[model samples]
Target: MFAKLKQRWQDTRTIMKLSLDAEQRALREGQQHPGAEHYTLAALDLPDGSARRVFARIGADPEAYRAALANRHTAALSAIGLAAANANVTPAGASSAADGLAPPAEPTLLFDAQPSGQTLMQSLPELQRRLPAPLCGAHVLLAAAAMAHSAAGRAFKAIDIDLQALGSAAEAELRAAIPS
Candidate 1:
């Protein structure tokens, strides 16, 4: 029982770390809440780089997906008559009705975990069951990719990446990392 509790505590800590990382991405993108997209970015930036390898293995460009995410945010702001002043490129020239958004918000270092974070937290047990053990970036991304209606899914669609291919690649990465 104590061992089980200890493992759960470790898992919780891991999830919290991922959430903090995702939240940083959200705040940097001027996103109100950290969702699957932010999580996807965080996963790609994970020190292990496991998620990134999946993209490379599949002959895909994670950088392009990152750009698409930026575009996604810019388009979102554009749709609301707001443009990101620091956006990489404006798809639509500034409209007379458009207003520029302020630079990315300051970090609060607080926990207001959102759905994608929650999804990652909830998925730990299932992930441990299916993958080797001790969750990593690949697991976080796999969860985001599995979300049928998430921003990550949309970004993949925008980048022309097949979701099944991504998921399969991520799974293979995890399995490959397991000690022989």
Candidate 2:
């Protein structure tokens, strides 16, 4: 049973590598955890896919999206009298104490134990039930959009992007990408 479970997990990892990579990148960049924004960013970074095409159709450049996200984060932090520069000051998994240095001058963003990757992973079984396999970029986009209350969703709304329409377009792209 353990072996079977391990195999299943590995298969899932293979299908979700891009999304997972995004989550890792977010952590490395000093995000407390990955969120819908991270997922979307990852999808955009794919070499070629539905997510990229969708952004292109909307005249949204990946760099511009990243800048917007950073600006939003900075604005939110500034409103609370916190500095955005400190948000990503420390590398992921590195502790100041471990380096014999004093603790950070400011408190870091507090995050729940459950990261966005877990949330995305939890959504996958349902997605697998509804969508065909070899989960592609479009699948990640749809999943991210489903997280309507996530930071990415709010950011999209602020920018006048339509999540529902984006999801529909992703689904169509996924269908087109698959061999009939």
Candidate 3:
């Protein structure tokens, strides 16, 4: 049974590698943006309908999808703050839209956990550390599993998968996704 499971895992990894390879080839030969492809693939890998919606919108206009997702997260966080207030949790320095007040200057600093003048500023090196090596190595494997789960197929979501004519778009997406 253990051997079977290991073989299954290996097979999944192989499938993910093939999918990524195909996507990359399509991007290179078809003149598609790699970031768009990455996000499109990422959407397929996700297990939620919300991600499907975001990816669908992204396929139409990448910028619009990015903004919509950001706005949704912001609204969710704001709602959490309001709920905490109702529970008498005394959320620190959180403001609601109803306040009709200007944005606080120190909000960013507070969120970043920076210290004041009296306290020595310390860096959390761990925060800057890349994801685990094993996790990174298993990327293709995860992608394969997602594909096998039928997440990568058209049945999952509708996306424009046109691959043709190489352009600067793929390079731009690669630059955006991979930090220099």
* Best candidate (score: TM-score): 1
Q: List clashing residue pairs in candidate 2.
A: none
- Among all candidates shown, the one with the greatest lDDT: 1
Q: In what order do the candidates fall by TM-score, top score first?
A: 1, 2, 3
The digit string of per-residue lDDT tens for model 1 on 87-158 reads: 433322122222244335544556665676567557756877888655678887678768867778888889
Clashes of each: 0, 0, 2
- TM-score between model 1 and native: 0.76
lDDT score, candidate 3, position 35: 22
Taking the tens digit of each residue's C-alpha lDDT, what string does model 2 give over 1-180?
986577567545644555555555455545545666766777776655667876666655656666667777778778999775573443322223323433323223332323555676567667755765445566777787777687666766666778887677767776666534
Q: Which pairs clash in the backbone of model 3?
A: 30-164, 31-165
Q: What is the lDDT of candidate 2?
A: 0.61
Better of 1 and 2 by TM-score: 1
Candidate 1 or 3, higher TM-score? 1
The candidates, ranked best first by lDDT, are 1, 2, 3
Show model 3 residue runs off by greater than 4 Å.
1-11, 14-41, 44-59, 82-180
